[model samples]
Target: MYHLPSSPTIRVLDRFSTLPDEYADDDQLVSFWPLLSAILLRPVSTTKDVVDALEEIAHVLRQSTGPAGDYGTLSKVLNALTFIDFPPGPHPGMTLRLSRSQAACLVAHQFLTSLASPRDRSEYYDFGIWYDSEQPHPRAAEMYITAMCVFFADLPDINILEEYATRDLEMGGGVSYVLASAPARSVGNTPMSPFRVLHNDVHVTGPHSPSSMDPNGALVVAANKVIGFGKSATGEEVTLGTTPEACPAVLVTPVLTGDQVVVITGASPVLRVTGERRNVAWEIPDTRTASADFDAWRMHRAGGPLLLMDALELDEHVSELGQVPDLVPENIEREVHKATTSFMATAATTVYTPLWGCGAFCGDPAVKMCLLWLAASMASVELVLLLDARGQALADELEPFVRRWQEKTAAELRQWLGRVPRTLRGGQVLAYIDT
Candidate 1:
């Protein structure tokens, strides 16, 4: 058997007058809060006593008829509390018979979850609790209203209220201020996936890669003609063989007017083309072939020629070369002409690299790692083109990548969460009140 504290009805009236005007129309005052608050504030001397108090509040609220004005407030409060289903439990205390205005206050208070300090209370009121001052989302307003109710209901002292108002206005405005500044977009609506560039031709080789080429390994060449150009105007060719040097290099016969054959080898060292010199490295006064000289090479042809050399080096060469090979007379003339024409036509064009897609919810470490891997992979592709240009095909490729990553990540998360212990299992509700 349960028991309710004496003067339960008077307690309700006292608390009702203290509710904020923001919840004037809320209805849950009679329907839920009195029972909930009693349950929350009641002592746990005997479980049966608490149950009796809860049953009394529920019985009184259900049978008692409220005036029209009070009923409207109760309706609003009830509507909001209905969002959260209350588990069956015993309650004890002076069960408050909340009026319509008080119900509204309870509804508003339940929504605010972030308010930490007393100062936040005044800031919340200044924002007009229900007014849509922050993000356009309805949840934001609902949260403010709920938090205020919880704060007032839990601590009903006037001194506490004054302290909260003063602190909120002075002490960094608390969590309500943060909520007011947050964007209204739903958690799931945030942009997580990035543009991902997909290309089968390009592959990156470095210390991070599982298969790093030996420093002294023989150079591997792929024979591929420039069939198309990337968004950066860099050439794209289907790799033809393991040894492109072995095959006859196709002479790019330039048909454009004012095009001159320029033989650009490693590091863009403009080889001096004389009738006497064939595949000879000429020492130009200003041009020097060093690690730092790669930047000068990238500036030409949207870095197409430089990208090709990098691709070749990643796949084939492991060690630094002493000198760049000068092609035969016909090959040199043809390459130089192609380079000159391509540069003139598309020098101003820009290249775009695509970022990879991410899972819906990723922890900090996982997100960082995922981004790092994505960046490395995009660099490996060497295709400075907008993946969207490929449209549906590019999107299709991303699906598998995202799926594999999500599965791997989810498994790890589940394993971690599994270690947490569950306390409640039986029908008896072991409610603990922090006093």
Candidate 2:
């Protein structure tokens, strides 16, 4: 419930109140309030052109009822909007919990109030790309908004409107956010979490895949969910990474807890709403309209949560050095340790991730895999790596490689990371470490 005209002193919309003819219909009021509130907030700032455009849209909404769509659904959406408010402020270990309906409302709120978010934000910041993009995509913004309407609508055996009303009663029915803190650095030999591998997409969901991870309460790793910690836009839901699997998962994330993905030292917890495979599969190129198959696109809480973590950027460093990047550069080993340690702090016993920081970040997958395995070992959580085609070779070599170093303490591993040859890349680096 972030009211527009943030300050009471700025009565920019007072002139509209004096005009009697504008406030005639209640339906108009229902639809008009969101637009009006946005205008008063002046999210993009008080530029004349932007103000004029918003006023024009508001004027159109005020005069016309628009469509014969379900006002009942709209009412539920509005009610959810009222209940949905971001935490008062972000501090260490702050927690905000929302039911499935409230989570949908949070997504809706992000879309409706996207104007207030920064314009220069990366595409990961909001759903504008899905709706506002000229090319014929799934229209994710409209789909999410419509999905909220359907979810909140009065239906048999389902009371979504009442879901948020009794949030305490629901057991794992909604999303929960915990700004996780970095874990204490370990020096002794910590028992390693069980390790496994899956050669598939990180976003893939089915019985054949690891979808059963929901019941175990797992936390899947999203590659680079948000960047730019301070001085970045606090609002808008952005994608995490540019990868085909990771980018579209933003639809499930709905909204970010604070400005950056890594607001805390290590991990930013996000709820990856399960059962909405079609909506999140944006790269598949949907030919149907946004409103198509509304009944099938419900958000199920079965998939559990996703841990949004950003790997250390090593592309520039690797390019400049003209040799293969090792795990020790820029305290990259410490960065990986912080993320895995943060994951260990959460309820999830397992963490599924790909070769993070390997793509545009230019991190060597072999080096990254070794570092992640070492960190996960220290955290005592099961690590299931979702490897692509290129990573299968590393996956084969990783087991024996890790087994050889399994007896080493955390301090010994760090010492070993520093001693590895800088000239070696990929499996060669792992071979050097093994030696």
Candidate 3:
């Protein structure tokens, strides 16, 4: 089971399993492979056991070279491993328990931080994932592999990520949106301000995307079979890249770290197309912390919701080669409903989406565009659609997409729902009525 095809940890271990130095030699770093593999076993294992294993790794890190290194780097990640109160959110109960599985992951990440730096973003590597087989979307395996090596092997510098965002905006990435025109806040261009939206309105907007790895609300990103954030190969996957932003920001920015890992893991897969996207619902403890630097200076991670919608299938191991869970109207409806509820609950002004299921996952853009509009129409939040930097393709797909729902009266909308083709709708959505 350690190498279970469906397990994120197994995928992680497999990547390193072949690396002689990482696992074979003494003091090579992966001295705890057996325990680490054991921690990721499914049929869900005990949390305390994983915690114990992590503590042992911590002991090694503390005694190895130095415990608290420069930037208190080791210390920062170590602190992130401790069990602190989960920030307040729509999922309050989920927040309370940082689950054993998550703890194992946090500790593994600390091991990485001790080896790397924030700006280095070790992903600054010389090579890519050379697949033993055709690695269609190597990101899934890469993400899990990287997760196991967070502070050690390779990490993408966060500042570089910000720079990427600015360049994307400037070049307009073959496509453009509403947010590009809006000025990047003076202090936090990388991590923009998150705001609350109480007013009921649908605004066609863009320029910013939750996928950009910076926004602080419920983020929507695709996941690989292992559920790691490395789903996007070119680093263009907005949701996946942005998923780590909130937690790491909180980890380094003292005001936000409540002595807990900034990550949140849902009890089950948030969206299981073929395999789980792992436990990546993030809740940084930045509920009340704000600065003159931040736009929604007062609104933190708790205030903003990061919604991770599992909308892709990169697991060649799953089923028929390209058969992915179709983002039918139902799945889209379900995701939108949850996102709307979270934003509404928190008064999050917008949901900066990057064509939720339209990327490598391959959801029909016209359909996704239509459904996205409907969902935002239903929720009435200012739905910000960020045609990503490389989203010329997506923009083209959505070119003919018309927000026709805005003109439809509630009664008429309901009637259209009934006549919609079977290909366009599903029962889960059929059962949902605004009233």
Candidate 4:
């Protein structure tokens, strides 16, 4: 039977203290670290023992999260899990927004089941990178062990603490999600919001993989899979094309269709406790320092709403584009334009975005920024672009255009983008405007 989750009950415990004997009466409350310590410390004699260890991990997760109420088992706490119950895919002109309690419940459900899938664990589990690496990443074992200790202790109350911390944001209409479409060609005088750059990762609160230096780590992709817990599974992957671009938990929302842009406001700037870059913070893992990385994410477990849009995975198409390493074709710019306008046109608030599609996706920063700027002008919503140090330089190169074109209407900018020389470099494409 299915059940809906409610607000998590907060129970405080001494951070450095050992498991107390008196608390044994509460089946719902499990001391996360001690149980894990016991499970890992035991010996594994055979392949069967290894399998049993995985089961033990799942059992521990179920115990820690506990059941929803008198009738709920922790594993069954969510209203739905498989795609059969929670349908996925983009629903144009629809919006699927969830309350804080509902979002937490969905995350909790993913915590219970996502790790159990062997395919998921094999491919996406952050810790697995360290485990399977032939020449393991530097200090891989230490990073894993430290994360195991600190991350779990923070889980039970993560949602409640986040709610308490972000109460002010929640009161101010909380996070809003809207899927918007491209702007019409007949643009008017929609004054663009001033653009600013910051040397930081996107403000969405989540942990990255320190060992391998990957930004979209457990916190971002799999909802804190770094904690090293899982439920047993029937060995099937989540059906493709029926899920969100990020974690399956995003499927929590009910209405998903609308315009082309998926704009989210009030996205929590997850508190940054370590060096801003993943490579800087996670490159040389130390037990003393690694725990802080997990703590940073732990403090903001109840994150704000996220806009789910997938960049074109351009790395795979390098063969088609030939020698121009960073060139963005005209079709690609349209996709970026669609992504920006949907959110900009409808939302009544400013949008915060990272350098979209510039990382592993291989997008050109200048092209992306131009497309976003044009789309926002059409929609008339303010746009704030988040950037790392490298992006700061690119922003500097483009600021001149931003100032010069401040008076240009959306229709004018759209026409300029259409005529952009595809052969010109991404940054150089904007330089053509002066000629």
TM-score of 4: 0.50
Candidate 2: lDDT over CA atoms? 0.43
Write one digit per residue (lDDT tens) for candidate 4, span 97-202: 3433333333333332213323223333222222222322333232322233233223334334345434534544333444445543444556655655545642
Per-candidate local distance difference test: 0.24, 0.43, 0.31, 0.39
Model 1, position 95: C-alpha lDDT score: 16
Provide the lDDT at 80 for model 2: 43
lDDT of 3: 0.31
What digit string (tens of lDDT, one per residue) describes model 1 on residues 1-435? 111223233223223333344423454243234434544454444434433443333234323221111222222433454222333432222212222122223222222111111221212211222322233333323332333333223322333333344343343221110000111111121222232334432232111111222221111111122211111111121111111111011112121232321211111112121111111111112331222222222222011121121111111321334312111223223332332232222122221222211111111212222332332232222113222233344345444444544323322322222332222111110111000
**1-435 per-residue lDDT for model 3 (tens digits):** 011112223212222233354444343444344424333332223333333333333344233222211212222332344332212111101011132212223333433322122232333111122111234444343332332333211222223323343343343221110100111111111211221212112211111322222343333333232222333342223232332322222122121111111223211111111112332222222222223332222122111344433443323223334332343334544444433333344334456565565546656554454445544445455555555344554454333322323444433443444444434322323333222
lDDT of 1: 0.24
Which of 2 and 4 is ahead in TM-score?
2
Q: Report the lDDT of model 3 for residue 409.
A: 46
Relative to the true structure, candidate 2 reaches a TM of 0.60
Q: TM-score of every model?
A: 0.17, 0.60, 0.36, 0.50
In model 4, where do residues sit more than 4 Å from their true spots? 1-101, 114-189, 200-305, 314-333, 345-348
Which candidate model has the greater lDDT, 1 or 4? Answer: 4
